[model samples]
Target: MLIDTYGRVATDLRVSLTDRCNLRCTYCMPEEGLSWLAKPDLLTDEEIVRLVRVAVTALGVTEVRFTGGEPLLRPGLVGIVQECAALEPRPQLSLTTNGIGLGRTAAALKEAGLDRVNVSLDTLRPEVFKTLTRRDRHQDVLAGLAAAHEAGLTPVKVNSVLMPGHNADEAPDLLAWAVAHDYELRFIEQMPLDAQHGWKREGMITAGDILASLRTRFTLTEEAGERGSAPAERWLVDGGPHRVGVIGSVTRPFCAACDRTRLTADGQIRTCLFASEETDLRAALRSGAPDEELARIWRQAMWGKKAGSGLDDPSFLQPQRPMSAIGG
Candidate 1:
């Protein structure tokens, strides 16, 4: 295991396949997105598989997740999943997508060894969806969710970002919809990862506000279980087995238990989502660095990992790269 100085073992690795996205979401970035990484600069499919192999074989990584500006936008996604699944003591594989392109590829992805998926859908209303995503593809997302579920991606999780004065009143509707469709729902407090650097903590929704709304519609009891390094705090809804998760990064920091790291599409390794800087793995990869050396570099990066991103610290500042570029 790659244990940080803080004693947190990194068992999960998030690899960004690409930074290109099909949608221009209001919450994700400004109407006009930033310049993307050149295709020649991004990691090839073979290079990505080799990196995953090292993490699973040389390190104690047990789970591998694919993230992107939108993961499905990557052409070799299925092949990536297949390569990861072929490893000895294979790591569990999952993906987080915006779901615009998922309907066409979910079954193929599942057939290739994907274990689960988390789709980002903020609102169910078509008008709200268009306003939020700057795209008229809410129905496409809905289709993709159904396709993922039908492909046996059990408990397909829906990741929604709660923004004040926007889609906040849809909590009850979102919950009821999740209950009816059997998809686990998680409402995340908006974080300061936007490409525009426009996130204001005061305007962002908090965990307390989310629970209060849930209480009005259904009962919520905090789950009495270990949180480990997982970001979401699980809770049982209305005394049923159905679970609802809340991620309060701004109000309730979980950096102390964050046993995860990220690799950018361009091959930079980031120990934290809000890290001020990243380690350039692409330089090593292009310089004929072996798996052992690559592993060593990863370890060295984590060795300096901080306890967490101190959002409340007076010196706190957003990363130069937006969330899309950072592979969150």
Candidate 2:
């Protein structure tokens, strides 16, 4: 197993298939669509599969998640999922999508061996959705969730960014909806990663506040289980199969247990989501480098991983690259 300097195991890998997205989420991208990575720089499906093999076989990676500006935008996503599922000691394969195009691809994705999905839905109101995502396709996202459920993608998760003035009031409603549908709902506190938009601390809705508000409506029982590297704290409502999770990355950073690393669409390996530094793997792959050499490069990159990110640092300085480019 490749343990970083922080003693964090490299167990989870989130690979971005593309930097292109269909929606312009206010928290992710700028109003004027941001410039995308050059097509030539993005890793091919073959390269992605090869890296996954190295991550699992050589680095002890047990879980692999496909992310992107929108992973479904990648033409060969199904093929990638198939290859990942076919690994010798097959890792748990999952995906994070905006759900704009999942309506038509859900069944195909499940057949291709995708184990689960997390759909981004910030609001249930159509106008609020349009204002948040700059796209009037809330109905499509809802349809995508139903389609995913129909396709046998068990435990479908809905991820909502709880922005203070934006979708804060809809928290209980979202949780109630998730409980009714038996879908795992996660309300994430907004981070300062979107520096391009001049994010302020006041704009954030703390996890404490959310839980306090939720406790008034639902009897939340603390979940006694092995938690993942994610910052989300899990809670089981009174009588529901679906659990509610609050990802307090901003107010409560789980940096010590951060076992996941990200690979950008252009093949740069990021040790942390809030990291500004990255190691480029595309250059090595394009130069006809051997697998051993590639692995060595990855090792070097992992070895240099920092103990914790600067998200909570008083001197925290946001990187020029937006959250989309970082594969958040």
Q: In order, what is each prediction's RMSD in angstroms?
A: 0.9, 1.3
Q: Point out the worst 10-residue segment of candidate 2 by lDDT.
A: 194-203
Model 1 lDDT-worst window of ten: 25-34
| Model 1, global lDDT | 0.89
Tens digits of per-residue lDDT, candidate 1, 166-211, equal: 7988887898899899999999988888888888877677888888
Candidate 1 lands at a TM-score of: 0.98
lDDT of 2: 0.86
lDDT of each structure?
A: 0.89, 0.86
Q: Best TM-score goes to which candidate?
A: 1
Clashing pairs in 2: none
Candidate 2 lDDT, 198-300, residue by residue in tens:
7777657889989988887898987887886867899988855558999888788888898887889899999888787899888998899887887888888
